[model samples]
Target: MRISRLRFPVLLAAVSASLTLHAEQTDLRVSPPGWWAGMASPKLQLMVHGPDIAGSTVSVNDSEFVIEQVNSLDSPNYLFIDIDIADISPGDYELTFTKQGKEIYKTIYTFRPRAANSAERQGFTQKDTIYLVTPDRFANGDESNDSVAGFVDKADRQAPGGRHGGDIQGMINHLDYIASTGFTQIWSMPLLENAMDDHSYHGYAITDYYRIDPRYGSNALYRQFSQQADEKGVGVIMDMVLNHIGSNHPWMKDKPAKDWIHHNGEFSATTHRRESLHDPHGVEADQKAFSDGWFVPSMPDLNQQNPYLTNYLIQNAIWWVEYANLSGIRVDTYSYSDKAFLSQWTARLTSEYPNLNIVGEEWTTNPVITAYWQEDSYRADGYDSSLPSVMDFPLQDTLVNALKDEETWGTGLVSLYNLLAGDFIYGDPYNLVIFGDNHDMSRIYTQLDESYALWDMAMTFLLTARGIPQIYYGTEILMANPDTDDHGVIRSDFPGGWKNDSIDAFAQQGLSPKQTKAYNRIKSLLSLRKEHPVVTQGKFTHFAPAEGIYVYFRTDEAGKGAMIILNKNEAENDVQLARFEPVLKEFSTASRWGNSNKISVKNASIEVAPKSASVWLLQ
Candidate 1:
């Protein structure tokens, strides 16, 4: 059995004592650990854990909070307390536990003060460009905590799958670099404890819901990182897992209920038929296999159908958003969780923070399947989703194929144009998160067969597209995993992230001619998006692809926006201005957005470089 050591939760460790079953007595463990008063929702559920603590009636001595109900299940070690926390003041309250009229346990519960206008906060939007990072491979700012005592995964730079000493301090150390890159937001993989014995660097199998991994940093440090990122004009987006937990999680050792885990805590691999959730004629057993099955034997699928477990997942998500003061969240394996519970989960979160953004990962190349989960899309089955955004897998797939495949009648760039033409299916197309590559797949550079020209065009189109653009960590420097798709190789450590590295990506030292150009071009494109409001809030328009050229435009009603052209020809081509007369006729001249050069539109055509993407600002 994999052993996991429990630590005091971040917000609430004020408990005095509780029933103990071990040789060394430990305080009562509470999830949420604590909560704040004056929240939009007056409800709070606390999952108190210890040894044989059931059959204990809970009571709040103070009138500020009321104990609505107390429930104990088959497990002798767990208690669920429902409290009405509407007007409680910010302080400690004594919770007394009695069994058979005898005081069995007592503890002090803490309530923290809410930040000013917290509920009125907004999440990441089309205006923000997100930089996706893998914290373990990004940088290692601290080596002292590289191999902690409890976590089995140790630091081994030689092993591609082992931890490489990256910590929260590394992210804190690079905020200036991130901000200078012109990205307004950062979405790293989950930083929660993974207490497994092997390959835990990916952080997908979570061992604790309320605590940040010590190998990454303490929970207090994570909060500090979020606050500091805000100082640099960049928001933090958390990656949350709702479908499964690490096999070593404390719950696996002592389940709160018999149905806490799906398939009775046994591993049953998923068929990975994600389309089953939306298939009109999908079989019931196939749907159950897709949702209830685990991704791997090492991770246990959660049973959200259990009401108590549902509350636990929802409250945990809210606690993180409030505790870390995060700007947004990215849900992992969104459809694998129970469908009804997902609706309730998202509704409760948005009800509290009305404008909050939560994007789900619904990895499918079909836009119709993706659209079935967004909030405003009317479903015939009467299922309403409160989710605000989804990762644009269709666009990502089409973009890569368009650039890599040979141009033909229905082959190359035309395929991409046709996909965008179907955008009417999405309720709010602009809210989607668009990207070329992420932590899960091979880097975009590798996918495009290491062609610098194709890489340049891909970056230009995605950055100017109609949705929130996200770029993987090292795309700017042309990181690639050639001849292999191993995740650890794709997520290799950044050049200057470690001590005594010969190459320093952060300082632009020891780079190839191609690498230097790639870095500069991406930085310029990001700056272009950041300074131009039309790129973020304007309507997108495009013309059909003819020959090897594809063109698009983004503009406000007054025609103040950008004109973009992507050329895949082997020779220079003169793009005819007559083809774009509707929006281009009003301007006699165009100013290059990134370089500030001038281009005259007074003639019938303009000459563009071969195999290049160009952008010009128009008013």
Candidate 2:
């Protein structure tokens, strides 16, 4: 007879001491591993990390099940077991574990069906506009659960710059507001559990990937949010982080092995040399440093090279996708993980979802480096990737340059002109995700020095240009935080998030005339995008950038074409009729505002006002 310690508290019946003594005690828990919080598979992993849990039989809903792979995961106690389902069928299941034919522990497993592919689901395609919202800062529907037990941080709903009580239910309650804004999809930051004291508000450093943050809501509440989004004709994109975990995560205290984290003991910061990872002639030292470096000592980097760790991370992502019925996934710090592991992760996810979209955050301006990582690019050096979309950092940089750089040959708006000129470098230029600003960077309004016209022009081009578009939260209202550069300040609370607040952007109750105009302009622009597919799926053509007067066309064979004229000059410039003739053939008339009767276009010189952009429909 083998001997084992009976440490856990148990209330056993006095039926047979032999069976109780012979029974195996199984300790099972699953996480996305350190700092890695999202995966794409419709699976949950119960990594048995202590004793011989294999002898402990597993069952789903009291039905017998199979446990594969008795492998160790770098950590001595870890025994990886996968929990999978056929198709994304929604239901509740009872997961029970029995050792020596005696039931010991059981838990509930709830799976939600993935959303059916529709035009709403197509919001992830290269054609739709995405509005990124941080629910905690966006709006607050409940002020009751702001403070919870085990979470050290206190609620400061009054602190404008501090964390307010914005839960998943709050977002769910305002689906109409989001849907009405003409945004087809909402990508919220991580809603996973983060019980850490100081930085729990951001939700990046996740403590539990499977469980929803209590302050945010329960796992069931998240599913309700997803369902609500679908009902409102909007898709949901989960914001995931695969780079690191919080210092207070349970795994940090009871790590399965010593090598589960990179440089756990001899911790050193990474060089953040993103280019070096894809460098053809790069040295091993450079590669290791980039991949192994900790994002911050507080956030521990995961060891993805370990087989168990890799499987755990990948499966966690899938579970959420299927569990929440997510339409797309937006990965945080796309270049921070092991490149080989990322390739495998993307391939598996796309293979499973097929039409599902995954956008990575590779914030680099060099198109070659960004393009090389995209799916189906034939790399000269033989590095393979299956990533579907990448954040268009080059175009974003060029756009900023267009607004700030003085008009010069091969510079300024010409930089933007030249950037689009190289669309041939991309496999599907339309697949790239374009954005002005995100949660990490400074707000776009601050970057443009509070120029409303410049911000509007950038928004127009991003929406009309050939690619998927993502707008940062509060951008529609021209929120700004300059010089300070504090991300918290930039991600300030929404005007009416608190129960007792004055300004209400959600209802448009309190607003200056200019602010209301900005809000209405964005709402109308997004509505236009939803109403017209010519802007989303039409072919893109551009004229040479001349003295800050940049023009582009989105035309299709159905005689539907929209010409966008952006005038950045201080003085209004007379646009030559010749500049419009090449693309506006046969259609000798145009509608300046896309609504009025078509106007004759015979040798007519149009004057484009300074600091404004106009979209005219050609007929």
Candidate 3:
């Protein structure tokens, strides 16, 4: 086992204080295990754990490395050593531990080299379409690691919430299929170790922050997968949980500090009142309950107010970005953590990797609440979370409502126009992650009540509208959870993921007519975004919904652009071009985006099919 994992005998077991120990027979554990020599910050804090290790003196023989301080928490078994690694050579360095004037232990620590231009790596932008996947339900490529020992959540294909044996290898095997679908980025659910007995497949309730779950694959395999993904033109984004962790985590039994967890590690449910953070009429107790309460009985909310714990989390995130070569991060439960710590966390991360993007999950349909968590552009309170982006929950809800509601003066497509009219509240609307549906909600096809036409219309708007687009796995073939909104069913196993599966979505075998059409529609539109390029960066201009016909134009600086027309009318509608003449007059020729047919844009009125979308490239 690598020293980075901090592998050692269980720290919960009692041990004799006077027992003699050496490198070969010691219970000591150190993290991160290794660090890069060159970083924006030179200080590295090593959390050392063992029996009676708190009072030991740490020393190094090298002059380049300096031990800043040794801090002993309330626990007698842990030591936090702060060291300066500025300009240190990339190699192994030995450190000795002495106690009571006697040499007790010695170990070698390593410093690694940063990959070329790692600090300048670019993050996902509007040009990239993100594919979200539920890892354990995505595929099962490694049968050997199906039910790893000590992890009670064994693979049970019949159980909706049970582990289905998907691993990093499964994703690695299907990179070509994903890339061919016109996706430029992949955002998988939490890939960290969730050691719970059941439902550990989601990867959200992390047990060990540094170790990847053995069931999924080793840490080495994950890093290799990310590097390989880059070769296929697909970037990787890690889903991180900063609010809480599994109750079974080792820290629950052997805490480094008394206040490491909120409410003394007991269960106190959070009100989930994110608006309380900035609510004008909220009480202090309600705000405290929302920020400091546990998410659930099995998930212990972390106390980021503790400075030591805060440093540990900040360092852990930086370690993963460096180790896995990540393109971005999606923070789960963004507003649940301490406000002050979140600001510090994001500032440090962005400072270290200036070009990296970090999007937080603030699930609120209120644009005002979501905008408060982003950078200062849309905020007036002078409080900055330093977050680069946030999920567009308002727009997602609006889109779904717009598609399903009956067309009326205030309902249906008009709701979409009204919601987006308030986009000015968002600091950078283009940076928000817009999606039809995610793992937490019913599938987009299901949300549209299984209407193939409505689903395709939603896909067209999602792909060509403002902001970056993210599609859930299996949505290409129009996967849906019709009977229920159970997350397990929503994140059901993908077809052809297992070898003996009856169907193969990847191979395009045994698909219904609607499924096939939906698949083709998504691929065609996504490819248009890549081919046209203007849609990703063009200025958005839209006409309010009128008579069930809505039109929007994506115009670039060169006056070249694309036009998206969505029609909800049950009968064919003639969309008058007079209102769009200002933008459409410049272009006399137009071609269907997903098809090869060329049409004239100078027509006074364009005939649009009933409940269909018309996308055209203008020239």
Q: How many clashes in each structure? A: 0, 8, 0
Q: Comparing 1 and 2 by lDDT, which wins?
A: 1
- For each candidate, give its TM-score against the true structure: 0.96, 0.88, 0.95
Cα-based lDDT for every prediction: 0.89, 0.76, 0.88
**Candidate 1 C-alpha lDDT tens digits along 322-416:** 99999999999998999999999999999989988999999999999888888897677889799999999999999999998899999899999
Ranking by lDDT, best first? 1, 3, 2
Can you tell me which runs of candidate 3 are displaced by over 4 Å? 1-26
Candidate 1: where are CA atoms >4 Å away?
A: 1-27
Q: What's model 1's overall lDDT?
A: 0.89
lDDT of 1 at 383: 94
Q: lDDT per residue, candidate 3, 1-619, as tens digits?
A: 1222232232112222333445433677788878887899888899987777888899987877688999998998888999988867776666777779887766667788889999999999989999999999998989999998898889897898989999999999999999998999999999899999899999889999999999999999999999999999999999999999998899999999999999998999999888888877779898899999987899999999999888899999999999999999999998999999999999999999998999999999988998888786556567877898999999999998998899999999999998888888777888989999999999999999999989988999999999999999999999999889898899999999998889899898988888888888988988889888898889888988899988998989897799899999999988877788888988887787756877776756778899999898999
How do the residues 330-414 of candidate 2 rate in per-residue lDDT, one tens digit apiece? 9998888988789888887776677789998888889987887788766787777888898999988889878877888876788
True-structure RMSD, every candidate: 4.2, 5.7, 4.0
